[model samples]
Target: MISMDEFIEFVRGGPLGPIKKWGTKWSLWPVHLVTACCGAELAHAFACGYDGERIGALNYGIARQTNLIIVEGAITRKMAKVLRITWEQMPDPKFVIVMGACGLQGGIFWNGYHMVKPSDVVPVDFFIPGCPPTPEALLRGIRQLQFKIETGEAKTSATFPEVPLEAGRKPRVLPKSPKKISKAPAVIVNAPKEVDWEFGQKLVEEIKAKVEAKSVTITGKNRIAVKVESDYIPRAAMRLREMGFDHVKNVNVIDVPNEDKFIVEYHFSSYSVKELMPVIVNVFADIPRENPRVKSLASMFPSADYMEREMHDFFGVIFEGNPWMGRKFLLAPDAPEFPLRKDFKLEEEVYVR
Candidate 1:
């Protein structure tokens, strides 16, 4: 009269319990999911030198075919979705092991705007701590997962020695940074440089004549900087297009909080002209930081569309005429609004004993 579910549970907890554990421990298949730089170590562990497969864990590329997931490195805001989806696709009785210092607690990228903890997205069974852990450390993590599977208890690979502290001694205070942090971001994007490219001199003269720029200076051999007012951004882009800069390589925004301005830069390069291919003309301008708005170059150069959307997501800068503005393009839907702003606060962590 017992149900099938009850019968299965009975078998699992009954005499066949050890058999199930033994089978699961030896055949741990970790799905391939590389979110950051820690992937290199994972590869090193499985490669010919280390041969991690000898221990029964194999790295599978497809999610449905695996029961274990090894999340490698920093999971950014956008990457959280992928991690969740992959975890969901796997069959039940699955396990997760997050490796690297970034996955554990953000490591060097502590308090970063886009960093996401892997445990936030899935049920992590174990964590392998290291900036980029040695291949041996990764293999040991696999063994820990296996031990957990066989015995229903997770074990630490290493234990630290307890150091005795001096009695009644005051804690030493470290000195603060000698340099004062600037209220505004200090970025030297357009420092003037001297170079000996004969073609660059002619090109500078041509750009000055065509584009209405505050100053047209050749920053380097293959670099030219054109500073313009916010209102003249679209016009300057159009004039540059007429010359030979057919595409926008990148669209960047610098948030200067103290100055109350945002510097919008468009790096333009050419595919149509052979001579202009090596030249990168940076057309940049300043706009009010409070409510920054710049004309979209998407219509003129389609590549600027995605970068423009990314800038809006980061700094809340409005790219006027861009169809995809004011939407979460590069970050997760629940990510903090305008996270790249100087005043944006990160979630604080609490340590409990």
Candidate 2:
């Protein structure tokens, strides 16, 4: 294995160093991680005579010999893990080119729960900003990467200057907006005020009747924060389902380091309960963060499949009963540790062996 000092010397002085100048001038190999909608322009970059290969830049399969990772677009929390792991797996002297606005910040998914900034995981070499760049724009990015390599510039610090995206352009080929469907006639003019279900009352009764936890606190309208013993979440979820809640809308866990407890919260709502339409019930439990563990709700809410995976990704809070809870999800596999907690600041740099 190459020692750190020898690796640095090889990067600066070997045959690898001399070839970089000429290779960058003619051989730009872009490894496509066609993550989202921006793949169209990426395809155009290599298509007939817009032919990226003519300039000696070719698209290659991800192999250790390959050193470029071009992030196409929106990487869901699940894919974020993949990006990180892939970065770690590539050989050293690797470079990253972040393509499109979505890859930078989450783009239209800015407020989406299942997202992490690409730069947060790996040191980005360049960011090509557009919803989907044109073939010419993609070629320009390759040229820029080659220029940087030729100049012996640091691959991790090259920044792509900002360009505004065109307004009102559809990112996907599908219709810009869904066609309006006819409204139901039953709730038209003079509709009676909707009956509200006392979800809180029903929830409390169900918990009291079924769960033997320490204390269940009710907080916020349509929200109940339960402080159950860690072992009973599965039972609580089953009881909540029996009480008519059908889906889990969000699964969030807050780490309270001061109290040495992780506040595990699962927000649940119902499809079968008409009167409970707007009500949302939040079931919470506290567990020690060091050994933070909770029952998986995938059985009760199939929609929570990815949510649990994401929570497991950032908090290091294991869902003991979850089917999929291994490796990276929102953060890269190369990331040092759980990053969402208050303690894990992005500015800190610590070398990992």
TM-scores, all candidates, are 0.90, 0.47
Backbone clash count, each prediction separately: 0, 1
Candidate 1 TM-score versus the reference: 0.90
> Can you give the lDDT of residue 295 in candidate 2?
83
Candidate 2 local Cα displacement, residue 51, angstroms: 24
| Residue-by-residue lDDT tens digits, candidate 2, 279-344 | 676677778878988888887689887898988888888997787776776565555567777456
Question: Taking the tens digit of each residue's C-alpha lDDT, what string does model 1 give over 1-353?
Answer: 99999898986788888888888889889996887788999999999999999999999989998999999888887888899999999987799999999999888887798888999999999999988988999999889988998888888979899999899989776654454555654766678887889999999999999998899988888999999999999899999999989999999998888878889999999999999999999999989987899999898889999999999999999999999987788788888899888778765555443
**Pairs clashing within candidate 1:** none
Per-candidate RMSD, Å: 2.7, 13.8
Model 2 misplacement above 4 A: 1-199, 348-353
